[model samples]
Target: MSLPPAFLDELRARVPLAPVVGRRVKLTRAGREWKGCCPFHNEKTPSFYVNDDKGFYHCFGCGAHGDVIRFLTEQEGMGFIDAVKQLAAQAGMEVPSESPEARARAEVADTLQSLAGRAAEWFQAQLRSTAGAEARAYLDRRGVSATMIKDFALGFSPESRTALKTALKDAGEDKLVEAGLLGRSDDGQTYDRFRGRLMFPIRDRRGRVVGFGGRALGDIQPKYLNSADGPLFDKGRLLYNLDRAGPVAHKSGRLVVVEGYMDVIGVAQAGIAELVAPLGTAMTETQLALAWRQVDEPILCFDGDGAGQRAALRACLRALPLLAPGKSLRIATLPPGEDPDDLVKRGGAPAFEVVLDAALPLSEYLWRSETEGQDTATPERRAAVRQRLKAHADAIADPSVRALYAADFNARFDALYFARPERPPRQAFVRGARYVAPLAGASPALRSRGPGARTASGEVTALLAGLLTHPGLADRHGEALAALPMSDPRQAELRDAILSALALSPDLESDALNADLVRRGVGGLADATLKSNRLRFSFTRRDAAADATARDFGMMVDTIAARTRIELELETATARFRSSLEDSDFERQQALLAERVEIDSAMMRLAESLRDD
Candidate 1:
């Protein structure tokens, strides 16, 4: 049974070809297509190739060729009807029944599509005629060449309300309205929808004219008007120039999304063919998915104005939930007061190329959007920034990508606000000088003196030694490490050095980290710290099991951090009790003292555990 061409087209658009072929053939991405060994014939090297943009597969080895349906019919040995049925099920489309009503509906769709093509032809003819003088002048003034006019099938609608209506009178007013070529008023008066405007034909993925976008010429309120949603057109789901841009984008490994048709036309005229535009709206999720099907990261080259930036942000937010590994967007901002068309027209494609080259990754753009020009001086303000960043990170649906984003944002936050303060130069350390570890079971009287009684410097040394032994620990517990208070200037310097190295390369091995630290003049500091403390703490020893060392190192860090917090609280409480001789202040001080004692006891237990391990 024959099916409507439009139905077949929709089916093809809905079902991606790569995944269909991939179920049978192990395919690897090769530029714009998937390549695999030919299943038609035994071959060691991959000769079969699938191009999703073009929706076809070919094999040089066996001289095999077919589309998705044909691939199943021939390769999998299924009948044509069975293949269509299975694909229709996958696409969630029911097969049109071979009934009179279905046939009539199909006929009407075909007729409307035919009328749209005819309307385009009439518009093109009118563009070259006297009726289109104003539109022609407008195009010429905008630097649109005649060749571009012909190539893009650009035309002009006459100023007469009934111009298109009269030209396509035989198509019937009802059919014309359904095709979005004519609009019917509430009083039942029918008229042309687009009048006296430079016309841009909007095509489907198969390059069939489905709708039109018109730029008003003379003092029109809505400067740009698109064809009303009809049987064939849904602006939110369709992108202008996608049909032509897909193949070009695939071949070049680049797809640029501009603001409007003029920007797309201007950029394409400059010989950059891989470009598209949303249909008179901020980019919708469907449009983004369509672009992603062609390229991994499509560049959004919006105008540099506030509106354009807002559009970019909306697109970014829309895409966050849909983002996956290797699937994302890059955003390019044109100069202030310039759109892509203006930029390209001014400095040629090179200027536009520079903007594209300098395009920021979506993550960077998001970061700047939240943090740029915002005051992060106070802890509360910085925390607010962090909460906003976390909200964005959590918007990502994929767990792995979400985790990575959260980690990256947290790292940036710490780097921006909690960066280790500079410390004095390390005092000269004599080689082979053994520094004793603080006693694990100190008396309550000594412990009351806070971390001072615990030899805070020795604990800091051990922590640094553990980090030097296993640089990976720094990556795992960066925030914790950054929060650790180091009184010794030498240890603080070494800790900062480690963090800086990890910031550069989070996966840096122990040897590379040590070498980097050594080059930064912290090698002796690390050596001195390790030699003095490694003998006391087993986790600092390079021979210890990594998992066990990490656990012990984390416990040691928590214990030290807790002790530091209690010491600060104790100091604050002491001042408050002295300043206000009130009972509440005294109770607060006493409570803090009790908490400090507990923390000190925990630190002692941690130290004893590390020594025993």
Candidate 2:
């Protein structure tokens, strides 16, 4: 829903700039404006400047500059609206809906959020009662404190399904359904989905409740039930503790990603506030991108199980490609069979600190742990291990990261061979394939997108992303993103999103753009604008930005051309099938037709979007 511009203006008027920027970046007096090392980029010199008086900022070093809204939006990697909403909330002023249409839509979202909030309160209150004793004991066993429970707003759902159903219905059920706390019967009767469980409200970086994660309090069937996807909660898109960890993440330039809520709560309680967790699923691109916003490096602290190893490997693969100049990742392994929850129980909070210190960089862990002398007596085993590790390295998209792994891997393998009693010839009579074969259905032409688009997209994405990541970016133009046409659906949708957020949250703060995109359903937009968006220069210091507009232009052109080619091929396939209705041929034609339909939809959206002036 779009919001009126006036709301943003009012929001900015309400909150002072000092508290917002001061939290992440250290600001000292510098003439009339405040100065700090640019948080958007690592810098030795303090070049970023902010003037609280006018609410405008500029960076002499990187050329990023904008209003407080832009800074918050850019720095926290939040879109415009989320930044504003976060800031406005801090000011204790509600972002009132603007037009009736916008207001109505906002109301639906707000109602669900409000319901979740009320349900959270009800759960917390019950925990204080006798019914919550076992839940409290469970927490105590896990080492979570009353203050920790209170801070996280932990609650228990009664064994009676209708208990929660009744509480929400009297207050409101439609919103509860919207928030994903309750479900409906086919006839439209509402019922609580999370019964007889301990509730953990999932909050965005700004601390508004988006959804919940529930653990069975006793021997409840299924053992664990979570809030399904709703207007607000997407299980794949959120981390468990983004709200509480963001500030610490930003300041420390690090993130500790554990596997569960109690793990996060335990670490936070133990004194490490910069901890987050993936909810049950493997860590996702959405979760990582959100973490990327707050810190330069992320420490994947999962259990030391094969499953956890697999999860860590998957995360490392996703992260390697993105961990170019500004980003890095470390893997922290717990003792066998112990998780963060267990470690916190056994050694208390300080145990986590010790584990964190022992964490290994990606190359170190993979080479040292996974490839260490696993019965290399067989050539097949050596080759198999090498193949597996090679596959892991190949997933790294960045040129530098891949090179690092290649060098480190070769060295480690060479060392292992020298230590062996018998070794295969260093080189094969015929060498094996150097790279993994492309997956079936992989686009043959995806690699052909022009470099210019990549460069432009990269710059715009980096600058904008940097701004969204660092509050100090509001004061520096080096981190500022060149605005795109607001009418272009892809860009326009984001613009509308940011604008609406501004109207609601005038101050413009976001923990990460990834979260904001999920909130607005534009993760695709965020990724497209960032991945191929490239630059030849260092993002921290560069020559004139490679024309930022070229990326959008190239993207539209590429999309149109690709669509046209597919359309023609599809038409040919369809015509061949129509000419003769042979069963086998007909099936092939249908397949082509289905692919064409998907291609056509994308073309239409792109075409219509480009048509938007």
Candidate 3:
């Protein structure tokens, strides 16, 4: 819900900007005002001046100037509504209701957050009390000290089924209901979500207590489980130990992503505080991107289980395409069935550290470890492995890493390792060795255009791109382009992106054009189309007549336009289908399914028609 504007305005009134921003920068007294360096932008000298009289701040360096609301939005990376909420809290002032909807929603979040805060305190309090004896003992047996448990906000949920439910009822049961802490029966009886479990408050990197991970206290059916889906937590996205380990990982220059939560806790407790874990899901692309942002390299320590070995292989595979120039990925394989946590317990944290230090680069590990003894003694087997190695090496996104790995791989596998006992030279495969899951159920569509098909489509996209990029072309070409049909959906999207870009801005630059297209959901379409335009430009820029360029553009445009018309026709056929048809029954259903399949297949082809820039 949108916030009441007045609440935000009043929030701006409280916690006067001069004082709030003054503490962050070196401010000089300048006639009822102050001046300091612009925190938003880099500046050699102080150009950020503040007027205490008006509660306004301005940076002459980058033209970033605003009041407290703007300050929080720019500096703290907070939304306007959240910043106002924060500023209101700073002022010790309750934000008066602005709108009915905003009031109701904010009240819900506020009440739940308050209830969670109180509940967290109670749980931590229990860890010190006698009721928490078992939980404390469990941690002690696991070698987690009081200091580490306290630091991680670790605590116990008493064996009673409703200890937290009763506590939250007294504090506020409405909050319990809202936060999903209580599960209601048909008769209105409520029970706790977690029972007889040890609690670990799951936190976001910013240290907000979003949810919880609960462990079964004793031998039970399921072991070491986390809370089910809640309003605040999505297990797939959350990383255990991120709050405690992120900074240390960032500071220490490497992150260790172990497979389990206790392993994270164990490693951190052992003073190897740079450990993190995914919330029991496979390491996803989103997690990789988030991990990449915090550190230069990540060492994945999968357990010694078979599943762990597969996970380690997957980590190497996924990291292949995402390997950046400076970033590195290393895989640390633990001994059979032992994880970092178990290893740390048996051999101490130093043992885990030694394993991490011995971690090999992902490419090296995947190529060498898997193929070290797999019939490599035979020439044919070595040839197959070497070919696969070359393919994986080619998949590395960083050129330098690829080059260095290639050199090292060649040095390791000399002529002594060969096929048919003949000396062989390294060769580049047409398509590299990395395996990409096909788009759903189908194989990769042909990316290369059919003979003479490329030039016409290329010209058309370039023309549309120019018309969209420069408004002047639309005036010249608007009338000559309406006769033919484009049979591709990607062509339609490209045309739409061009038209949309033209409507928003007459003289479109690259960034603005691409951003507008992305906002419209044909995100990368504009970039690909523009790259095609660049190709056409480079090819024909010298001594090509304006008419020739336009003619070539016209050719490509007609081809794409034809594809787009066909796309709309196919879309119309599938849009009118029903799950339960009244007319022809099975025959209609089968026909509808076929039409839908064709449309989908056609769209896939259309997308593939536009290759990588």
Candidate 4:
């Protein structure tokens, strides 16, 4: 027995064609469709194409063409009934046991679909009539072109509530109401659900009109109204302009997802054909899945304002759990107070193209979204940042991707907290050092005079011990301390301990701070490391104020880090210069030579920033 047409349509919609063929053929996305070597014949320029939107697989080489059912029967060698049963089970539909009631329901749905399509045509006809002059003018004012109006099937609903009810009276009010074209009030009076509004018809994958979205003609409370979910229309499962966009997206290999119907039309007007929009709601998982069926990573272009940013962030979080190896989202945030439509209108497609080219990857956007405007100077605040990153990273469902996300966040956090900036040299000590003063007239050529370029483990040990003796210096030099390079494992441990102690007890005395370090398991290493240096401490006088010691400690640490940076750059340049000469890369060699001079100038400036005590 033949199955019901409604059940077959639902099955085709539910069980996307890509996965069914992907089981046997190794399909890779090519444009808006999946491409692979033909499963029927032995040739491999990849002429076989499977389009999820069209629900079919076609091969240009072998001339094999079929929908999901035909592909299964041909490739899997299954009988017709067996193939239908299998696809029905995968689509979550029970094979229909032929019954009178089931056939009647299918007939009713067919009638509703037919009524909705007719309603869309009637609305478009009304839009061209004199009654639609206001709607036509509104579209013109919005810069919607004549071609776009006809292409998108832009239309209008008449002001009279009973006009549609009266015109389609022959079709029966029950079917009209069921199709979402008319509404029946509590008093049993019938009227049009959409009146005096410009209409955009929403189509299913097969390019059949399933519903309508109406935009208010004037200043109204709700700017847009979508068709109610019925046997034919479910907003969450459908996207506007998707049917037209699918083929174009296959050629462009890009799918731009905007926020509104007009935005989609505007983008297309600006010469971007591979685009779609949600039906007056934030993107749903089903919608995202549909988008992924078209492209590996769809670009999400949102307004650059706070609300748009929040919406993008929400999409990011929602997508984390659903992310697979090849599927993700790219975030393109427009400049503040602008959206895709406004940007395209002002600067044209190229301007919007620049924004698309610079769109951030999902990972980068997530990092910026969580870290932007956040103060990571204090240890507590830094910890909070780390926790937020962890929460986001942990939410990713893919095990490998989750671990990589965590590692990436940790690397960024370390760079933010432990990378050192350049500093001035330590002050030379007297028999009883009291107050160290800044150096004067320090120059680049006089490198040894500032910090002596001597970063032996012993000198670094002394610098760290000095900071420990004056934990208050951690607060005074918080910026520098936060950036201190912790190449040595012991230094890294001590750095954490110092920051933790200061964060918890900013007013702790030196003795108490030292005890806290010991309790934290770094005090013993600190003593041993400092004693091993065997160098005289320069600014440890009893009369020295905490500020004096902080100043001395900061200058010394910065000077060390700065000198080390310059020397490393010099060495890198020398190696590159030698390699470039070997490869006869004169341009790169010349660039390196110029870079060395710039490095020398930077070193000189660093030395000049310091002064003698």
Candidate 5:
């Protein structure tokens, strides 16, 4: 018995050919086609090619050529009818018997395709008529050139209920309704489904018009209207403009997926011909599979706004389960408040090209989406970040990919939390009026200035600025700073006052730290220090500045403490040498001389380190 031609076509379209042949053959992607050894004959080198895009398999060595049905019969050693039955069962299609009802239905399907083509032509004629003048003006205002209008086959539908019904009266009411071009009321009244709107013809892969999508000219609810699914149009199975973009994508090795029809047209007008858009919905798996068939990685161009970001996240989640070794997506976000159409019109094609060139890979986009705007300052928040990352990584179906994601996230966490700089040891020293004189080799003016000199003053200023810009540094290093000896009496008083305030209140950010300093009555000093050295320690990114300050502040504190210890030792050694004398005190004098030499060496090293800092 012969099966219905429609059933066979649907089976072939639904079942991808690569997986069917890959059951026995170890096929690998070679450019746009999958290559494997010919199953019919033994051969070491692979010359057999299977192309899902073209829906055929060809062997270069043996010159074997056929469709999916032919492959099943020949490879599996099954008869033609048996192969059809098995493939039909796998595709969830019922094989047809020689019955009158089935034949009538198949004929109806053919008639619907014919009617849909005629309806598209009728809409095109309406667009040229006087009734479509408003639609023409709207297109002109959008900067759509006449050539694009013709190429995209844009049209218009009139508001009259009977215009389409009257145009295709020869096809009868039931046929037009079956074609999804007209709707029927309960009382037997038939009206146009799409009226007074700009029309876009939706075509199948073979470039045949299967349905229409209409955009309203005025404030209509549901800004766009698409044809209801029927015999020819399966919304999920076909992408808009695929018939045109397929060849361009094959040549360019890239495919750009956008949100709407106009975006597709605008991008193509900007000289990028390899692009497609979904049919008035979020991208489906079938659409992604179609894109992957053309190119391994398609660039998804979304808006930079909140809604667009949400769409991108949704796409990433859906694609995780379907990901293979070399197949994925790249995401390009347009500038804020701009879509592809808006961007091209304002800055020309190069602006859109810039966004495409900087597209983020799937892994990078996923990481940023999960971690953006999250603060890891507190333990609770840091744990929350890790959990969120794990949840996303675990969703990936591929085990190896999940492992890689886990390792990357853990490394990033360590950099943020565990990787800390070493703190040099602080030595004991005498507290002498909270003052230490500058180096002896200094100029007379510098020596006379004492602690108030610009060099020393600048050091204190920078330290205070670091604490102010990254107040969390204060929380982490407050205990050390409170116990360390100070060289300036004013700075010592300020430190004690601020530390006392911070002891009472924790989680004080930069602004709160400033407020606490103000309450301590040392606000003026803090203000002056920040104002003078704004260039040296200005606030930029909080996270980056905090990391740098955490290292620099510790080093500065240790340097100061080291210098103080060396000076105190020098004083003690000089006193001992003067007090001890004669043969009986010879050993004490020699001990004093050794102590003086050690102090001088330490002082030199500290001075050099300070100069380097």
Candidate 6:
């Protein structure tokens, strides 16, 4: 039985090519495509490739090529119908039977799509006619070039209600109403849904016109209006410009989501092709999924205004439950009272590029949204913030990703709110009676025991050792460990090797990690660091309890990071004091000295705590 073309297309989109082909061929990722040895013909070197983005596989060795359907039929020797049935089942789609009713429904859907296309053409003709002067002038005011207008299929609907109906009269009234071109009132009176408005044709991924979005040229309520849901279009399931943006986003590994049609068009006019927009609504899960399929983290560019910020937060909340490893969003805030169209129009793509460059990852954006402008000065307020952050992190469906997010949020919270030790009263300074240098008179034992005694390199070595003993810590502290400053090339190489191994196999145990590191030529470094007497912390012990090891490892990382910051501050203050010799510089140096002392005491306390455990 013949299936609808739409159903077949949906099947291709739903079932990724990699897994389907991987069942028979061992595919390894090569750029955006997967490479595997051709199952059809055997050779030493691999030449078969499958591209999920294009939903096809090709073998350069034997010149074999086809999509998932063809692969199943040719490789598995399944009949065409059986191959399609298997894919349909895999995609969780019911195969359309070739019954008269189903055929009629399919025919109606096709007719509606065709009518929508013809309606688009009619609107374009109207935009070029004398009745479209207002729409043309509005486009000019928005700095939309003629080329852009044509490229995006920008058009207009005349002010009269019957203009489109009369233009496409042969399509009949019922089909026009069904296609969302005309609205029927309770009294059974039908009228044009869009009048005196700028028109945007919303197309499916196949570039078929599915619906229309209208921006009122004059003073109209609900400045933008989208077609009501119909068989051909569901706004929640579609993103504007997705048909064009998918291939570009896949190629560049960058996808951008804006707020509306003009934003997409404006950004595209600036030479960026990987852009899409929700049809006048907050992004839906399906829409976000579509964007994720194109790129792992699509940038959601929103205006910096309060409404824009709220929209962005809503999108974040919607996305939290759907986030998985490497699948999340980055948010870029436009200048207040500005959008992509405004920014691009005023300063071109370079201006938009700056915003994109400063985009915040999902975790950072969530933290800021929950804490920015809120009072976290008190313990109660801070506890509330923690609870809220935990709740959001808990929404993530993937356990490993959720745990990592929670750990990351905890680290950020400590850094921002709890890192600073309470300052001593100003009276304790005695107006800087005499500024003593930091740690100058400490005993050698105290100096050697303090976090300040270890260079950044030594601390990194100890951190790596702890990680090697407890490779599971990589799930929670991988990002932090990766960010640790390493000056020694050998230490950095070992650090990268450890992280790479963990990434390749997140559940790798200590022995497996050691083996993998050795394979990468850094096993000696790992062994030497572990065997050295320097890392005496309990967390580095093989027999340490999991909870204690994780806690102690976190403390070690925090202490090292704090020491690095204070050392940098001390160096800057010393440089300024040497140059100016001013009392303020001296006072600043002394204050930093106090902070440094406090950090050393904290480190000693941590050592004591770990030893007690």
Compare candidates 5 and 6 on TM-score and give the better one.
6
Q: What's the lDDT of the predicted structure labeled candidate 6?
A: 0.81
In what order do the candidates fall by lDDT, top score first? 6, 1, 4, 5, 2, 3
Best by TM-score: 2
Candidate 6's residue-wise lDDT over 537-608, tens digit each? 777788879998898888788787787667656655554444334687678778987898899888778767
* Candidate 5 RMSD to the correct structure: 28.0
Model 5 TM-score? 0.54
**Candidate 3 Cα outliers beyond 4 Å, as residue runs:** 1-110, 170-178, 184-189, 376-613
Higher-scoring candidate on lDDT, 1 or 5: 1
Compose the digit string of candidate 4's lDDT tens values, residues 294-364: 67799998788888888788878888888887889999988899988889899999999999999999999
lDDT of prediction 2? 0.66
- lDDT per model vs. reference: 0.80, 0.66, 0.64, 0.74, 0.72, 0.81
Alpha-carbon error at 385 in model 3, in Å?
5.1
Please give the lDDT score for candidate 4.
Answer: 0.74
**Better-scoring candidate (TM-score), 3 or 4:** 4
Per-residue alpha-carbon lDDT of model 3 for 109-161, expressed as tens digits? 66666666666787788878898888888888888877888788887777776
Weakest 10 consecutive residues of candidate 1 by summed lDDT: 434-443
lDDT of 2 by residue, 37-94 (tens): 8776678998777777767666655555677777775566565678877787788877
| Clashing pairs in model 5, backbone N/Cα/C closer than 3 A | none
Ranking of candidates on TM-score, top first: 2, 6, 1, 4, 5, 3
- lDDT by residue for model 1 over 276-372, one digit each (tens)? 9998899998898888877789999888999998999999999999999899999998889999899988999999999999999999999999999
